[model samples]
Target: MCLLLIAWKVHPTCPLIVAANRDEFYRRPTKPIHRWDDGSGIVGGRDLTSGGTWLGVTASGRFAAVTNVRDGKAEGTPPQSRGALPTGFLDSTATPQAYAAAADGDDFAGFNLLASDLDELFWVSNRFDGAGVAVEPGIHGLSNAQLDTPWPKVTAGKAALAAAVSEDSGAPDADVESYFELLHSTDPAPRADLPNTGVGVRREKQLSPLFVRTRFYGTRASTVLRVRSDGSFDLTERTFNSRRQTGETRIEETS
Candidate 1:
């Protein structure tokens, strides 16, 4: 299970709160946040499969994110590498609203996209039975298996992020860094079974309270993006080690 949550403008302190947990096999090759493309911008984590990204914004006030829909057997179509969607969004100039609008009736193929260009944000999910959806700025969440579930983790994370954003507007950078720390606060004790277990012994481990669970499918990367009224952008990305230790990089760029 994975979850993504977003909170916009209504918060008194911060304008946005995005917390997501990306779930996949533990052996996937991913790099924590780092400077990308000759240092023109910075992004957190890279999905080595398709070279796409999960979250990132350019110094030029452009932003976008995407999550794979767990409901698909997206295997024989076009054969694009995994995570290519987010990678493409990172380098593009499409605004969220425009991108969503453009995707309104197109075939979704096999993913969901969150595209933004300085002023607006957009969401489109091909997994939603082939329809694209427009989601406004507010507290929002999504998981790999579904759009939004009433799962306790989704509720708690969204609420916590919302509350924190409402309480701290002083330095977006500081608030963002603290938020990353909070997201990465998971225990590192090795588990005897895989999270998505098919083994009988794993079933026993899943039943153990100490087995450790992930909120948003073990948040692999965390990001914060801010846009000034003048249309410039500032962004930061924090990547976590397998042990969940964290490091961050910040960038500022004009549109």
Candidate 2:
């Protein structure tokens, strides 16, 4: 996932809510979110080429998601795929901190990972030094740089998410459609506000929007995952094909 907005332990009834968009090349092969028939008990979209997932959740209440760091100066492909980072955590019984510490950051390209066991949440980034730090209970944002980096999109997204959560809090059911509407925003940041991530200005401009749409590369999926107080969760993913919504998959499981 490229853009992630999270509201953790903020609502009265829900404890965790995540809204994310996964951006990738249009030619990349991917499978829409679904349960792993391999008995992994994991539900997420699969990167068919790499055989790993961007974000996923388990019936046991474990959740994980990862986003690649945008660094054009970094040369040489990393030895491992960053997708494995999240799947590794979801498939393990270890606590978030321990799992993050054991991960060999040098083995993979720059990445930011979020892991949770429904008890606590942690954020780890291979691009920086230090172990995974516990994520505070509040609304947070993440993009290509770092957690809560205040990129234009991140800032706007966090505010939009907070408003959405506020409107849905205490309600009988979450307004899942509203969350998707937020992610569907195609408005681009002003040129003066765009960040220089080493990608050329043209490319950077193309990626400045909350929902990216380019000729070859753009947001491929938008996902919303909500975990209620009872441990029951809802996950919905919408896949896109050249800016057109192609399919959607939703999974809701009771505790």
Candidate 3:
């Protein structure tokens, strides 16, 4: 996922609320969220090319998401696909911290990963020595940077997400729609505020919004998930391209 806005322990009934958009090239083969054929008890989109996933959840209350770090230089290809970071987390019996600590940072390209179990959230980055940090509860944002880095989009997304949740008066449907609206914005940040990720000004402008659009690359999927303290949850995935949308899939489940 390129952009993720999470309201962790901010809602009384819902412990986790996620609004996220995944950006990728249109040519990459992908499948929308589904029960994994391997009986992993996991549900999320799969990267057909890499046999991994960017984001997914398990019935046992484990959640994982990943974003590629933006490095200007190309190192050809890494030995491992970063998507496996999340898929492996959901598939294993390990805690989030153990899984993150075990990752061999040298095997993959630069990546920022978030892995959480029922009680705590953990963050690990291969670019930053592969140590894991527990994420505290509250509103948080992540993109192609360190956790809660004040990049323009991250800052705006966190604020928008906080507003969306606080304004939601216990209505699930309207609340989810409001969160989607926040993710659907395509406004570019002012040039002065764009982060210097080594990519040029023009490229930075293209990725400034919560939702991004470009000829060959853009947001392919948007997802909203709400996990209640009791483990019942609502998950929705919307797929689209630059010109128009493909479809939306909704999955609701209880513990």
- Candidate 1: where is the Cα deviation over 4 Å? 12-14, 38-44, 72-78, 101-109, 129-131, 145-147, 170-173, 185-218, 226-228, 231-234, 244-246, 252-255
Count of clashing pairs, candidate 3: 0
**Sequence-dependent TM-score of model 1:** 0.70
Displacement of the residue 137 alpha carbon in candidate 2, Å: 0.6
Clash count for each candidate, listed in order shown: 7, 0, 0
For each candidate, the alpha-carbon lDDT, in order, equals 0.54, 0.89, 0.87
Arrange candidates by lDDT, descending. Answer: 2, 3, 1
State which candidate has the highest lDDT: 2
Q: Write the per-residue lDDT of candidate 3 for residues 142-244, one digit (tens) a residue.
A: 9998889999889999999999989765434544788889889999999999999888999999999999999999999999888777776778999987788
The better-scoring model by TM-score among 1 and 3 is 3
Model 2 segments more than 4 A misplaced = 169-173
Could you tell me the lDDT of residue 28 within candidate 2?
95
Better of 1 and 2 by TM-score: 2
On lDDT, the stronger of 1 and 3 is 3
**Pairing residues by index, what is the TM-score of model 2?**
0.96
- Each prediction's RMSD over C-alphas, in Å, is 5.8, 1.3, 1.4
Total clashes for model 2: 0
